[model samples]
Target: MNNGTPHNTTGTMSANVSYYNENFVANSKFAIVKYSDRFFLQACMAFEGVSQYIDFWIPANIPGDGSIIELSLAANGGNLASYSRFPDGVALRARSGRLLMKYDWQTKRMEGNFSFEIQNGSTIVQISDGTFDLTGIVDGVSNSSIYGVGTFTAYSDQLGSFEAQEVSIELKDRSHVGLPNYWQIIGRMEKPEFPHPQRSHIALQVVEHVETKIHTLGNNPDAWASYFQEPDVGIIPAVNGTLEFTTLPNTGHTEGRLDADFRTAENVLIHVSGIFDIKQAKR
Candidate 1:
């Protein structure tokens, strides 16, 4: 389904896609396309669990550098942020600021940097010094190999917010025979508090597949989580205080939201919240 660029297509002459491009499937395509009097940007990228996206009203033309363009959750009855996980985004507005769009019409490229603010009821995302480029974006649909995606984010009262250096969430049932747990969400970060310069890895689990709910470690073995690291420091059988999926679970997709606060018998806290949509392992 790699249909190539939009160079030969009608009204799609000027288009490009800039993304991680890790998977060859449809999920790998993150694009921006503009034609006639509207701009459309759609992305499935992630900053760990907190994804930044736009799927709604964008001004029809370039406002030039050092100018501001208002963003609306509803314009012409269309949700600009169609992919946002926030519950209420109509009130989500940006900070009064200008985005410097250094666009090049001849090259069909656009680049800019701006930091804005938006909120969905109580959930707020302060887009800190965000930058974007659509010099090589896409203007076509994808194949049928991809589906839903999830989100993850976490905060600590003890320490500031942090993101995982790596994330690997999967279905334990696919890897383990007779394993009761249905899902395994794992993340890792650097830990200087430990003995050596090793990374701290945490993995959480849930017994049911319908949703990811908070579960205490000792309550039952059906739904639980654990933590460990390299060099065998110590292991912590853990519990989750908050866990949620962005949407209801369905077949062929495993994307949802997650927030977990787990600890060891030594009271070491391992907190993580993010979104994921890793495909179910092949049967």
Candidate 2:
């Protein structure tokens, strides 16, 4: 079945493919194959119950040649993330070509030379004109040597293809609640019973105080209550203020100093101030 020869079809493309590539057969050695909008091959190979081997194959609709493969779980309905363990085993022997896979958050692209070992033999990888064709025995048999369209390396060592799971949360009527804001009255300067040269007493004035909290309201009412009840739930608060303080001298004259602290509900603190306001009050 080598050499552009359309081999016999065990199953049509529209039908579920029981084989791995053109040669890699789906044996009971690993796991079973499942199909949806995409095909998933899952298998777990155990060794001494300590070490494990696994393989997950996902077919790409990308036209083979030198085209970017866009993979996404139909369930999740987004671009597929780049996978590591699911290494690009398909080797294109030809030069002057680039193998591009979608970029995951960690890496920019998935590119590699595809190599295969068949029946206890050395790893053989063929590259012709920038096209990699992986044709090797999977389990001591060439019958299962199908060119892997793609694979996914799960975060766990276990191998398997996961369709993107669609998940969504909504807020019923909390559009008005919004984020949380906070303010704390800090230390205040005062004249001790023992008078000093600083003059009269210093009175604390709470010009303004604000508190805010941010959070995502769950779709269900119960879920929202549970979420808000948690010690830490919501977005960062956005609130500010202008604090003005005045000090009076027993001589019927007034002077003062001003200090302001800007803070978020998350307890993040900052000092923002200008100057104190000194004005005489008309009796």
Best by lDDT: 1
Off by over 4 Å in 1: 1-153, 157-161, 174-181, 190-196, 208-218, 229-234, 248-252, 255-260, 268-283
Q: Candidate 2 lDDT, tens digit per residue, 70-93?
A: 332221222111111101111111
- Give the range of the ten consecutive residues with the poorest summed lDDT in model 2: 226-235
TM-score to true structure, per model? 0.33, 0.17
**lDDT at residue 229 of model 2 (Cα atoms):** 7
* Clash count, predicted structure 1: 19
TM-score of 1: 0.33
Give one digit per residue, the lDDT tens place, for model 1 in 158-190: 333445565554554321122343556655666
